[model samples]
Target: MPVVTYTLWRLSLFAVTLVVLVWVGMGSWLAIVLAAVIAWALSYVLLGRQRDAAALHLAQRAKPGRSAPADAEVEDAALDAAERERGAA
Candidate 1:
């Protein structure tokens, strides 16, 4: 859930920044661009912990030797059975 939390936080920051910029008489396009940059900068500085947690979570999920999904396991079993049958025949 760290990834989800981090994503929500970033999106919330961007939305608030956009609203504030638009309220200050900035054009919509300019406000969007500036808000995105501002939000990214602010999050990078202020949300370091959350960013690290999210990164760690992603890294763990992508690490080698993780368990295969059930579908993959089942597929492997089927392939093994087919190969054994072919060998026996």
Candidate 2:
């Protein structure tokens, strides 16, 4: 499954669990905490494949260039210009 789809699936599962718990008389905080724990556990057990696939996909799609130093190219250009001026003189 895609990362977005997998994320939505997890969120929906948590919401459903929380709603059920709340309807059954659990307080909001307790329901939210329980739902989070339950969802975390279930996702580990039941959605392992999907989670792994999403992680792999994300890793594969990540680009090192996307995080390169912003000033690297400009600095290289300035250094080259200075070198050329020094050599000419």
Candidate 3:
């Protein structure tokens, strides 16, 4: 999985855990801390593949002179393609 996806999954897990703990009469502060710890432990134990993929992606992107393209450039290219298709039609 991509880094963004993995991050979102982890965040979602934390949020859900926090909500459940709070719903069950736990103090908000305590719930928050427990949620964080539980989510991290769960992720560490169960999400090795995703974590590894995300770490590798981050490492590659962090390398000097190596980075993903900007979103604007991707959007421009997509728009150009659409325009060409319209012209052809």
lDDT of each: 0.94, 0.87, 0.89
Q: lDDT tens digits, residues 19-71, model 1?
A: 99999999999999999999999999999999999999999988655865666
- TM-score list, all predictions: 0.76, 0.70, 0.67
Identify the leading candidate in terms of lDDT: 1
Q: What is the lDDT for 56 in model 2?
A: 89
Q: Candidate 2 — which residues are off by over 4 angstroms?
A: 63-89
**Candidate 3 residue-wise lDDT, 3-26, digit = tens:** 988999899889988999999999
Higher-scoring candidate on lDDT, 1 or 3: 1
Model 1: colliding residue pairs = none
Off by over 4 Å in 3: 67-89
lDDT score for candidate 1 against the true structure: 0.94
Q: Could you tell me which 10 consecutive residues in candidate 3 have the lowest summed lDDT?
A: 63-72
- All candidates in order of TM-score, best leading: 1, 2, 3
Candidate 2 lDDT tens digits, 1-89? 48988899899889999989999999989899999999898888888888988998888667555666447787898999999999999
Considering lDDT, which of the candidate structures 1 and 2 is the better prediction for this target?
1
Q: If both were scored by TM-score, which would come out higher, candidate 1 or candidate 2? A: 1
